[model samples]
Target chain A: MTDRNPMKDQVAIVGLGSTGFSREGGASSLSMALAAATEAITDAGLTAADIDGIVATNEPGASGPEAIAAGLGITEATHHTKPTPVAVFSLLDAARAVFTGAADHVLVVTPVVMGPWNSRRAAADPWRRGARSGILPVPEDATMAAAYAAWASRYIHEFGATKDPFARVAINSRTNAAANPLAAVDTPLSFGAYEAARMIREPLNIYDMDLPVDGADAFVLTSAERARSLPHTPVLIHAATSGIVGKNDEDQLDGLHRTGQHVVVDQLRRTSDIWIDDIDLFYPYEGFTIITLTWFENCGFCPPGEAERFLREHWNDDAQRIEIHGRIPVNTHGGSLSEGATRGTGHLREAVHQLRGTAGARQVDGARAALVTPGGFFFNPQGAVLRTAT
Target chain B: MNGNSEETDEETDDVLIARFAGNGITRDSADHFRGRLDRRLLMARCADCGRWQHPPRPMCPACWSWNMTMDEVSGRGTIHLLMVLHQGPPATGVDYSTGHPVVTVELEEQRALRFTSTVSDDFPAEDLAIGTAVEVEWIERDGTPMPVFRKAAS
Candidate 1:
């Protein structure tokens, strides 16, 4: 395949592993990385000795590639590097390494050891800094939430979208999480509870935010030919891309709340063989409720400014709740909203599980193709389209 | 003992310097234009293309030219979006009383150029809504004037 369809039918996700997600009391970031990487390599019917390349995405301190390689007793890791730190970017980096013949087999790993976000304890925390755009002198804690709130408010005012759809997304995620044994927040969140929850920032309650928990997710990528000999079914990486746009700060903020869907989906369609409607499973990377709504519109599921209405009509049917068999079974692993915030890696892992027909209780039936988007804030939104061998 | 104490003091100085010298929004972007806003607000206009920008930059975004000029303008804007922060305090270490309203104001200078600032606590939350006209009202905190907003008279 050429760059027009780079990695399509060529690179396959041979193995996937996660240090079963937890809210607390797991290993440290480095330990989690090692555990997940070991599991992934073993799951692929290989050992650490077979991995020649490693990509570590944004897990700081002793969790870089060298640390993980040493922890795994991998002495021959010739290719090691860190990407933009976003989880999806790490997967893309690993895939690129394999595609270019720079490495034979590549492992991508990110472990998020969650507790109280102690910015002071870790100086390298990317979120510990102020707004990069300098659009406002926003303090670190208030940077993203405040930005999200503004977008929600503007969206509500413009489209007459209420809190109903936003709250529904929160409820739907928890509902999906209830079946996922590895999900952190699986307790049923009622509609009333969501409406009455304490506002973290106005227009957004505490439930709107992603649950930060201690966990790690890992994936192994090799050539499609090599994947056939592995222990599991190969999930073909059809399209993987990162999207950016040139716009004013205000316009960028709007795009950010939408998870940069316009740029990301357009990029995906250009290179992929299928359109949005063809995918059986969709994983919209969500850190909040409104983000999911924006993804629906940005991914061509609905017209612009019409996601709330679309969800209100098509998504709220009691017989067709967003489950594995429901209309557009989104985020079958509960997503970052309910699944642990391994950044976007958890969603990626979940997509692989469904494509492999091994998602256990949360498996989407006859799931052949899947679309997974991984993004936070607005910046570099990334995504991948995966399909089982046809 | 005297020499050791002197050495300790120098090491502490170095730690402080390194801590504060870490990267963030530079003064040229945030503070350099404060003197201009002391009386009236100003936006940076590209000398090459004459495009205005907020959170002023050293060079033009439109033309990438180093030549930039500040143009005086009305500090008036409309509240495009608004939110109230109630949880943890900001990095500024200021715990606002019962939390306060933070707003994104679409400046009258350019429809796309917006500024994010706080609303004066004196204004009741009920009186505010998106599209409400507001003008800059400087609030002096720790002897530094920061721009906040209040409802503009009809």
Candidate 2:
């Protein structure tokens, strides 16, 4: 069977906007989505009526594309999508809609409410029950952090890596976030403080976890040709791909460092002639510190088991001077760790900003292209290469 | 370790018992391979591909064969991974606020059958390490039997 040519440099992200990251209570999911979506459309110099496609990240009963469309007073959407689980998937959908001539001016939105919940409180929410019963078969006795902790344990065992590298990741993320005015947690992370942090799980402390924050992030995608006619410089969608390993439904009990992850990285690289060195910035999802570590290895940033060493030799060398500002910066917007986790949509928005040179304080110097990978437990991993329109 | 199933309908004050939400549910296709802590036999192997799997599913992941069989595995393995959670949602009435170590074991019979269970309070926390050998035992929490692990004698 002939492989389909990569959908490289076809679509461009014309506008990127967010309601800024917060620790909840500012607004509801629909309101945040509306604000972000509206910002994106207006930033693209297009009215809501100009958007004909909508792709909303699906959170059951959570307001989706239809609500955002109506909230924006968009009269109609010719190609509306059901709520998707992953932001990258929604992005791919938006890009495809523009690529396939399905629609122009596609809007993608994901909003999340990041607040604490308890078992008793969960019992009161009908939507919570549906999530527990139908979609995720998580054991009741299992703690929320069990899965990542397990993967980390195995990673430590197999690689002989210590918690120091993971600590560094948290430190770097916070250091970057400190420069970000909209970051949820902007406090500078020191190694001493990170080490002193109480361990929530062995080998994982509070520093290793990503804080849940309330906010929404949205983007506007159109044909590269169309993007040229718009207001802002277009961040061309150079390449993109998404898939799962073994089976999509298999419980990932084996571990997080899957063979399939390498496949994704390779396929994304093949989408364009761009090598890893050509990319100016990197944004691997930081849901957990170990996630970034594994991505570093699997995404071919460094050889296997060399991520920690690479960090030691390169990242930690100039912590105060070059930590946030680096040769190839990772998570310039602080990522989910310090930047608010808008269910990971924040990473995409940050990538677009970095590419456009619009990321003010945390901007990477002369960033022309970026590699963004979004992944988590049970997610069909997805990735994209975004480059500035030359 | 073997014991009768602690199947009950009455609400118990056991926090871990309260956490056991999949109490009544059972998969129909793989009834032979039971995960109940009380079961002497656990895990299923594909009769066609000889692949061993746990939390029993219908087909073999390796060979995708419907031919499968069940048998008891040696209730011993090394801790493949572990997490000691200090702060977590409180179990119904039990005070786990101090936290507990959750472990995943790579079974000696088949590494694919990784079983996750909490270590007993008596298990040495300071000694826990990856690759440390452990043995399974059935214990009752508020009269509800569940599987737990203890460090194996060297």
Interface RMSD of each: 4.2, 4.0
Residues A1-390 of candidate 1 have per-residue lDDT tens digits of 256775777888988878777654535677778888888888888888899999987554336787778888886976799776566688788888888898888998888764334323322444322313222334322245466777787778888878987877777778788888878888878878988898877888888878657677788999888999998999988888887565524333533334456777887888898767688888887787777777777787777678767766766456224533244688877778787556788788888999888899887788889888877446657788889898
Tens digits of per-residue lDDT, candidate 1, B1-154, equal 1111234455644543333332133334432233323645666777788888765777777789877776766778888877777754443534545666777777887756776767775765776888899988877554445577899867
Query: Following a full C-alpha superposition, what root-mean-square deviation does model 2 have from the true structure?
Result: 4.8
Q: Which ten residues in a row have the lowest lDDT in candidate 1 chain A?
A: A127-136
How far residue A270's Cα lies from its native spot in candidate 1, in Å, is: 0.9
Model 2 DockQ class: acceptable
* Per-candidate alpha-carbon RMSD to the true structure: 6.4, 4.8
All candidates' lDDT scores? 0.72, 0.71
Could you tell me every candidate's TM-score relative to the true structure?
0.87, 0.87
**lDDT at A20 for candidate 2?**
82
> Which of the CAPRI classes, incorrect, acceptable, medium or high, describes model 1?
acceptable
Over A125-151, each residue of candidate 2 has an lDDT whose tens digit, in order, gives: 454434332322322232234567777
Minimum summed lDDT over a 10-residue window in model 2 chain A is located at A133-142
List each candidate's DockQ score: 0.31, 0.33
